[model samples]
Target: MTDAVDPPAERLLHDLGITEPGEIDVEVIACAVGAVVRYRRLGVGDARIVGLGDRAIITVDNRASRVRQRFSVAHELGHWHHHRGRRLICHGAADQQVGVAGCEREADGYAADLLMPRFMLEPLVAGVPMSFDLVYQTAAAFGVSAMAAALRLADVHPAAFALVVEEADGRRWFRRSASLNPRWFVRSAASGVSVTADRYGLSRANATFAAPAQRWFLGQGAKDAQAFQTIDVMVCGRAIHLIVVA
Candidate 1:
């Protein structure tokens, strides 16, 4: 019996010689799907598909400096190949994308899995040194953006991880996985709400500090069942740290 989920998208990624980061083939994917592949400084795109009824339109905005349009194009093509006939529009920085669960998130996962397969990420993450420059270089090696690399590392790497992005003005959106067991009780004294990455990582940072040390947590079923860890990272630039605890 056929599995409920489609495996062709992933299978094509591997078969197309894109089993690593830098090996994305935007042109090929564009040709295959009859989509137009172009580069622009248009702010954001992690594979956005304009799924008009009759045919699907795919476009990848290469505006961001961190990741290449190649991966973006491939990412869009992921939606085209697997999610054809469905209108999928992905906006914002790959890191700051809105909503936690649903098609957008699923497509993002699919994009990462396709562009930076576990096979390549495992060995690469295991062997490579961790640093901003080195990390950027690795992302370059994979032909993906730095943020994209960080996202993948957070998933497969055993170390505790957190990705912080700083835009022109301040902190944007940041997500910490289970490995990053942040302290949950430390609610903001002012707002009384749980502090998120955008609150500190980008929004508030400015002239003074280069790096900040803070803690956050991921809550489980019960209030007490929260995971916590301390994240020490840079104030600006895209920072991904291998935290101490898991």
Candidate 2:
């Protein structure tokens, strides 16, 4: 064996208290098997994600504190663990396009997978009464950021759910799975409207949406609302524009 994952490399999952690591175990195995032949190199910066010769590169904002750095590190680890053959380079997160092939989006997904594995999260959140408080509590149990927890909760919401992120006191992130259907902008109609409008200010977590005309909040309609079961949630104490339908 020319080289391996340095032992502690795999411990990141353990440190996070993840026992069964799920696919991460497979990733670790691949990293171990490939580390000898793959010949990987790792570096970090606040630049767009890219791949060099046998290495994954990461760029980060220097003025930013450790959380971003740590997240970057974990992100780079994701590239190394899951997408090893490719030389990965990242500019961290940018103005995301609402479609696939988003590196930032992939990194966010990978980070969630690594830190909050299905093995750990699946059992904890099951039947855990959907609520912003409940979601936050589950996230705390996993030792991940509230936003991370919120994202996971939104991603894995049982019936139908979506998560909204607000930047500058407005919603900036939107996520909806197959179980949900939300126009979300029948009120704004703008291409990218700030989610902090007074329309959402009155919104609270666990609120259900079945509204007829309203897209942001739960409407009281039974049929239209039956299309999805919408719920509201918040992130980092900021309002999270949420919708769960059908």
Candidate 3:
């Protein structure tokens, strides 16, 4: 499992005296780390970083959403912190894959810790039930996308849950809650639980409902099927399902 607290980013936050979500100013943080963030019209990628010694320049696409731009800047800061004196170009699909490069994954993890620090996020999610509403609320509070919020929630929320993202083409990726058992693996699909759009382009969203454990959990008995529940949300041609053990 990836460490929930990024020592460097967390130490940076602490050193900067950031104690709340509103205090996570990516540009200011970048400046503190000796990187100057700039916005430009990019034809290829979402963001890039070029660094020499301690000073660096991070260029992010100006056309992206505010949340995305912020995340992009934070991601480049991650690169600047870890892989300094190097150049890298990153894509905009922040929640697209689990099998990314080691360095890219590192940067993504750093960005997550920077944007939604454990100190601030864990308190809000503790003892609260996992659902779409909670995810959206967290997103709104942190100025991040729902997908980013969901992934970070899974990382910090003390629950046995898994977030599954199914693409329009049926490709899937998932992030497991920290408390989830490693022995339990997620299935490709849950039959009655419609994660993607159907023939009429209709999909389920904004509600938690029952789904068979066998349908979502691999190698589960019928007796255990009733203990599982799911909340589905649709975003940008993708379907995200929050599977929880009740």
Candidate 4:
């Protein structure tokens, strides 16, 4: 998302003089915003927030990874800021997808903004090309999942690319940069034979290759596809491709 989208999160960072990624202490920030963060084994959701007036308590799942815990805290903080006076239980990132409720998406956006504000993330990805290395690096630096970093990078990075996640069952979804042509719909894993599918489980040292636009695109975009390339890498047994316009 753009820097202008959420003013409260950005304003909070500004008020606290938080200019660096490591400075974003979600617990501390939550406390500053009248919320107390707690950790426990949550059986129902990743996190939950209960608010009374200005003060609130955020409970996160302790069994989750540190990055996940951080995101849960930030997400509850989002609900605390936007949906105060109401109790909420969030399942996880899957609930943050497009078709979910507006409130959930809003909270997700808030969490993203709070965790990886554009002001901080932009500079990190300023001139870097999108790749698994860049995504993993950003994830490490920001204490977020590679998926989150990839989506955020696609949002702020000045490149026309897409981060595609293909499941073992061949299901797929993607997040594309704004500069990517609107017509460039990614081809489904089952619809066509692709080098990416064939190259999985291989070393990533020379994974980057020039492939025909038709190899990745479909319909109008495929017909008018520009010179493009892909960097396919196996991330946690899932096929991840960084499709970049060449």
Best by lDDT: 3
C-alpha lDDT (0 to 100) for residue 102 of candidate 1: 63
Give the C-alpha lDDT of model 2. Answer: 0.48
Tens-digit lDDT track of model 4 for 141-221: 999876667777777788877766766666677767888778777665423566455565565533577766666666565
Mind sharing the TM-score for model 4? 0.85
**Please, what's the RMSD in Å of model 3?**
2.8
Clashes of each: 16, 34, 0, 0
CA shift at 81, candidate 3, in angstroms? 1.2
Prediction 2 TM-score vs. true: 0.56
Query: For residues 19-60, could you state the per-residue lDDT of candidate 2 as single tens digits?
Result: 753334433433443321121232444333445455434444
Which has the higher lDDT value, candidate number 1 or candidate number 2?
1
User: How much is 38 displaced in model 3, in angstroms?
Assistant: 0.6
What lDDT would each prediction earn against the true structure?
0.51, 0.48, 0.77, 0.74
lDDT of 4: 0.74
Model 3, position 199, has a per-residue lDDT of 34
Candidate with the greatest TM-score versus the true structure? 3
For TM-score, candidate 1 versus 2, the one ahead is: 1
